[model samples]
Target: MRVQLKHPARLALALAFGFITASAAAAQEPTPEPQPAPAPAPEPAPAPEEPAPQDPAPEKCEVVIDAAGVPINAEPVTVKASFSRDIGQPARAQVASESGVRVLSAEPDAETPLTFTLTLDTSAGNAGDWAIALEGEGGACEGTISVLPASAPPSR
Candidate 1:
């Protein structure tokens, strides 16, 4: 079973047969299985944003002191103190004197004039005037109250 390619026609046929066999072998050879395209690199996460700045609130203001006067009474009597403007909420009342008179209680109303009905006890206080002050969350006002001797009883 020996074949010779000495003639021109036999040489051409041999070359064509060799080329076809090479092609067939190449086609049958297992090509590297296409690797799944590497999953695209995961995209980077986005950054968080900062909040906008805000303005600060205004400060508490002082109110006007229109009038501060006590009408009457010194023996556990309530007195009213009127203001000209808003004074927030009346927190408390303070009283001072050169004698024994003092304030028993203080109550604030939520209406105009900013009235403070203060109970003043003058039983153990001397007959004189005392300083009365009203303090609130926003402002303060001060005035004076007089304590005097009661009138004597007439003869029966």
Candidate 2:
């Protein structure tokens, strides 16, 4: 068959090819998608566990001591102190004298209630009106000690 290239027909063919090429290009390109909103942040988890109970506070205890009125002249004086359940630990007792005497030793009761034998240094002149003190695990107890002078001979 004999072919004829007319101006209108050529223009029409070109336009058709352009449309096809544009459509093919568009089909090959990827389409943009609408992004989903970010998921709401999860609420913080509840606290791990409950705390344990605490022990009750200790009660005030009564402390007492007794000794002979007779004075014994010695380098290391011996005075006895007694403690009961009313009193706490035996280690807290502190013995002192008004004369600023040194405490050589404090012997705690091994059995039964807590008793202490406070040894003092006579060199410090720690005799007459000495003050004995007791202390608990807490602070010092009220009116701890009283070291009276040795018993004197009756006057004629």
The most accurate candidate by TM-score is: 1
Task: Output the TM-score of candidate 1.
Answer: 0.45
Q: Which regions in candidate 2 have their CA more than 4 angstroms from the true location? A: 1-63, 70-72, 84-97, 136-139, 142-156
What clash pairs does model 2 have?
71-150, 132-145
The digit string of per-residue lDDT tens for model 1 on 1-156 reads: 897667899889888999999999999999998888788888889888867768655443332223343333444766566655556676776667564666677676546456666677766666656666667787766666665655566879
Q: What digit string (tens of lDDT, one per residue) describes model 2 on residues 1-156?
A: 977667888979999999999999999999999999999999999999977768765554444556543143445667666654434543444445455556577666666456656676654354454455666554444334444444576899
Question: lDDT for every model?
Answer: 0.63, 0.59
**TM-score, every prediction:** 0.45, 0.40
